[model samples]
Target: MNPDNREWERVDEKMILVMRLTGAGKSYFIQQLTGMNVSAGHELKVHILYLANFVAGTEKCQVIQTSIGNTDFAIMDTPGFDGTTRSDAEILKVITEQLSIIRLGYNLKGIVYLHRITDNRMGGSAMRSLDIFEKLVGEDALSNVVLATTMWGNVVDIAAANRRDSELREEYWGSMRRRGSTATRFDGTRESARAIVEQLLGKKAVVLKVQEELVDREMSLNQTAAGVLLELEVYAEAEQIRKRLEQLESELKYEKDSNKRLEVKRSQRRNAKAFSQCAEDKKTMKSKPGVEVKGKLKKWAESGGKIGLQALQGLAAIVSISFGIAGFILGAGF
Candidate 1:
């Protein structure tokens, strides 16, 4: 059977996207909502690198069709922005391709972005994922977004969790909340999952920014808002590494002890390797469609050849990518 024709047969069904960082309970939540026998576990394992293929049971996007209170909708399970085995660019390509397929038959009714409430602090990967998500949704579709916090049952310290929740709303999620995005909790229950889905059942389906950019405007993936944000993030990381290498060089020149000097030299070599990797990543990005290398170089030169610290102040932490599913859901893979 033709997949496109099969999708077209379900034209009346509303579409919803489930997105977040790895280990954020996306598959587990979908299992609760659709009662699918999806793979889910509490402990993140090293072998579980890719969410879409290993966890969600398919490399291509899978739409699990289910009815919620007489309303038939399809929930699309997506790969995380921080996949251990996949670059953000590769993941974005997969997502945008699937989205383009869905655009032929249906519009997105809502998006559910899950976060771990148990996390005391948001890491760099989480922050970068959130930034890219916002750009993909655009300001106009903020009302259709649900910022759902998961793993509430795992929190032993209720007060600290609440404080973290408040901090997320006030600092990280403030602008989104003010612009009509909602904050909710997922308590690892079927009822809670249904309730979250119910919130979007009545909302009017709208085209997401990515859909508009890729399908409507016919723009290349590298030219979209989310793509630009990812590029800037990569550039910022490279600049920071460059600055650190310069500092290490200065410190090595003034060091008097041989042991300290050896340590500094070791650090320099490590930083140099990392900088080389970043340069390769930039080359990959530039090779994508619609990226003009000369134009980007000109822009970099115009900005005094340095990325502003203010642009990426809190994103200095190294990303530690992991993947897992909550144990509350079914333990078998689909």
Candidate 2:
């Protein structure tokens, strides 16, 4: 305190300040960034310093700190300051106290303004929070405010999602271009955490190896396993496409065959109707007496001639049977 009067090192110091609103996972984000277990009791020197008592013994603010790699950063978890609830006012007081403490005791680098990805509709709460941030940090602190969208793991499509992420960023800092506090999106997951960490460190993309976290066992059967996963996926997709195409072809063939059958039935019906009409016309012409009698004789022969000659033979047989019975009775009497 006597020798070095400066609170912070220099402008190019590797110190960072992470500030996010409530429920934005400020504590969890800091833990992930530093790869430290900042749980209830997880062997870490991280502690939450209540800033409320610093200003007034009644109110206090909470700040989370962790050392990421070689750099030491301060992560600030601010409470809701919308002044809508009694607890909110207390939290707002704590936030102001913490800001005062930072300005007086510590050197501020940049601020990460945490906003929920789901909270797309920016109402009065967000506006009031921004206003408080602006008033407490001043116009110069605008460059330090990093508009960070937290809970980004909930977003399915970062590019296609209908989230009001850009609107809020632009609306809040559209005029503060001089400060040049760039806005960035981050996913709240291990993969996203790694990516964000690399981006902050200005490093290249590093592939994280897949690690089995569950129970491990020694394999008794030593065999090399082939990766057919991609092949299986391709085969399944191709089979589905083939089945769909076959169904379409079968439907088209059925339609064509039905149409052909319908045409054949229509043609048959037309031919039968024409033949019936011609027969009717021939009957009409034959009804006149001037028509040839040869046609009637031909029809009688076509009836097999039994209709006329067979009836006559039956009458003759009945008469012969009656005579034979009478002759037999007379002979017996004589």
Candidate 3:
């Protein structure tokens, strides 16, 4: 658990749960929305983890107070479920515990889930996370949820992003919208974050599915739906790694090619590491008790290949040659 997590623990301030995958601007959004810097002479400030350039910046949960309209509200910032350093089980355990504690004290406005606008597709990890989120929120309170796409400034083509947004509205996130989850954009600005929060201010307060299950219903991790789903995923990963290892072993038995065997052996090693991690996670899940969840740039240097770079280079050569010839002919005529 974050040591400073409950430092600002109070009941009066209304709470909003903001979540996103790592590097999806979850912290940045919260930091901007609160408009409070670290110890800049403000009563409420968000503490951000200092990370190196290569690694994703955020690593923990921050619960802080920021006023929206005339009322002061508490915003609980969460780390991504797929974040590095901690296992998903550990992360979820800490988050659900903290949320449940807060829920007991005060009313929670709703959940706000953010996604990257530049992401071309909602991949497997994201989809699975969404499934767990649904189980966490439950069907009844899902209408209070907001599935907002963010980082609009990063995308060069607004039209392309709009098309993807429409698809999310119609197909990808269509079911969520139908169930009452509103789709919006963060626009990567403080104004956008405030606007979104304003809409949620003074809204209905509902108990999260996980909170009700664990706190009210007193359900164990295994008994809750989201917890069960995560356990199954851990088991599935282990099973998948085991099957691949068996397949590689069988292939090595019949194969005479030394190079191929070496490749398979290396693959087995990596899968072995992943399997070991998965097994440990499964153990943690069984032991712990929280039911909860959850680019196209055309530069040859970026392309790292001769195809696009060479294609552009070739096209440039052709254009140059044609222009050169035209200039010569025109000069001769003159």
Best by lDDT: 1
Q: Model 2, which residues run further than 4 Å from truth?
A: 1-18, 36-60, 82-89, 156-163, 190-334
**Candidate 3 residue pairs in backbone clash:** none
lDDT by residue for model 1 (109-210), tens: 899999999888999989989999999889999999999999888999999999999999889999999999999899988889988988887899877887
Candidate 3 overall lDDT versus native: 0.63
Better of 1 and 2 by TM-score: 1
Residue range 1-334, candidate 2, lDDT tens digits? 2112332222222223445555666656655654545552122342332111122223222344433445444444445554333233234323333332233233455556667777757766676566555544445445555567777678777764444776756776566544555566766654555354334444221110000000011111111011122123334554554565455555555665777657655655554554454343333322211111222323433555321211212221321110000000011111
- Every model's Cα RMSD, please? 12.3, 48.8, 19.4
What value does the lDDT take at residue 296 in candidate 2? 30
Q: What ranking emerges by lDDT with the best candidate at the front? A: 1, 3, 2
Better of 2 and 3 by TM-score: 3
Count of backbone clashes for each model? 1, 4, 0
lDDT of 1: 0.68
Task: Encode model 3's per-residue lDDT on 96-176: one tens digit a residue.
Answer: 665555444457788899888898998887877778788888888787788888888899998999998898788878888
Model 3 residue runs over 4 Å out of place are 1-10, 37-59, 246-269, 288-334
Which of the predicted structures, 2 or 3, would earn the higher lDDT when compared with the native?
A: 3
